[model samples]
Target: MSGHQMPATESVWDYPRPPALLRETRRITVECGGDVVADTTKALKILETSHPPVFYVPPDDVRTDLLRAAPRRSWCEWKGSAEYWDVVVGTDIRPLAAWSYPAPRPPYELLIGHVAFYAGRVDRCTVGGCTVLPQEGDFYGGWITPEVKGPFKGGGHTHGW
Candidate 1:
């Protein structure tokens, strides 16, 4: 986690606690079952210690008609409760593939009703035309692009981190 190790990289360890938001203009596109579920150049990235960035696209860019409310819900200490969504495209259905904080807590009010898709669950997720790699762990929804560096914390032996 030493910054000296990789001069050109931003260590996740150096990222702030409670997370931070970075607005990006890179083209972000999500596809599922041959259909474009989301496409936008305006996206907000969530950065936190031990994790890659999680991009949240505005609802206007997402195909809401393809998303159905899921039964599951989860809570975050900083962001508040999250509601899941099942994406349906053509005959394909990916349940709990996306999530949103319809009513986020303070400091995260920007994320309200904004949608974030799990790269691992979707057919493909791209950033600036480069397909993104999903964070190693099953639970985290971080997207790993070449511009991001890791020793990321979502994989094995990261529980205590």
Candidate 2:
């Protein structure tokens, strides 16, 4: 919706810094290479300022067999270190398509064993039966559904925000 926030949609600016981890009951699903990689109704969503919510599905709900650890790691000031994962389905592979905070810091310890996928890296990701738009830029993993409005960070020129 560009710079304007739509009615009934949550503005990203209203989200908190350091992020808030909240339980989400909406169905979350991820598919890639013709297979459903993850599906869950019990997910945790990270709500951060200037970003759309990022959904994290418990490992038990994901097809962990299809994921291979990638030799990549990243740090989040609030969530702690993240380990990347590659999704492999037969001969098809999507590198570093998902990530998790195996040992999250305080206030984020609930993220342990939960995985979050990059919507842009998978064939499809749906929240409550609605396909989501990926947050812009390569780094952020936010999922943009109809209820979340944004002048989101991650797009070019928004890095300084």
Candidate 3:
């Protein structure tokens, strides 16, 4: 798939291959099951080629009491193994709604204490003051904001990308 950068917008194609982990001060928030699960102005974003940025919030900023350890785990070539967390609010439970790399590979080790959520799995997620859109598939947890343009890689048939 092809994509073009627009004025005032960033093209996912312009992002790096190994992915750049950058800190952001914009307000990022996540809500689910009628409760605010996470809220933070200090966040880390993972910008990779052909995908929107994935915002990772520090564990201290999240409501840890509301998160339960999940049984699911996954491996990433760049970040190493990841552990999942389920968001629990009263009787509502979102299974494996968030993930983090407890022991990431080099360059990604900075992500140690941060957690990234799946926008589609959560009730809502916002960057700055704008709501976010989940990257086009279930596999990738990229958050699509207005300033990021995409012909993103998460959709069907993009596995070979």
Candidate 4:
């Protein structure tokens, strides 16, 4: 746990902060088929890591129609505004991959809209049960769910991490 070291202009929190799952956290879950979208009971955060802990839900629970809004954008001056996602798994495509921030920036503003996923473009990246392995540079696939246990860094196949 050590990655929120922001200090180029100084800005980390002013409000909206409540997520750090670790007390079982309802065993965690993020489904896309049987709905259930993302469940953790309440807020869940673990922002201090080498990478593998980002469960900031609260965008209406997130089922957002299998996510389909990827005009492509990236920027994180310490968690502010960022949008992405193209995970339409019923047919199979995997675009933008997944990203979320909505309007963060008040110490993260509770992740504004909340939404993070890259476990390699999402398709089947479980954790605790073991089933990661991909992250290297291809659009990220790290930090899935279950209990965090596997390999997910960027994905594999060669594209444009």
Compared with the true structure, what per-residue lDDT tens digits does model 4 show for residues 1-161?
A: 79855323211122123423332343334654444455445545544332345555566766777889989877755665588878675776578766887776656565666676665555443433345443466543345433444333334533331
Q: List the residue pairs that clash in candidate 3.
A: none
| Sort order, lDDT high to low | 2, 3, 1, 4
TM-score of 2: 0.94
Which predicted model would earn the best lDDT?
2
lDDT of 2 by residue, 60-107 (tens): 999999999999999999988999999999999999999999999999
Rank all candidate structures by their TM-score, best first, as comma-separated numbers: 2, 3, 1, 4
Please list the residue runs of candidate 4 whose C-alpha ends up more than 4 Å from where it truly belongs after superposition: 1-32, 44-69, 74-79, 92-99, 109-113, 116-161
Instruction: State the displacement of the C-alpha of residue 14, model 2, in Å, after optimal TM-score superposition.
Output: 0.3
lDDT tens per residue, model 3, 4-91: 6543889999999899999999999999999999999989999999989999999899998988999999998899999999999999
Is 2 or 3 the stronger prediction by lDDT? Answer: 2
Off by over 4 Å in 2: 1-7
Q: Which ten residues in a row have the lowest lDDT in candidate 3?
A: 1-10
TM-score of each: 0.91, 0.94, 0.93, 0.27
Winner on TM-score between 1 and 2 is 2
Better of 2 and 4 by TM-score: 2
By TM-score, who's the top model here? 2
Q: How accurate is candidate 3 locally (lDDT)?
A: 0.92
lDDT for model 2, please.
Answer: 0.95
Worst 10 residues of 2 by lDDT: 1-10
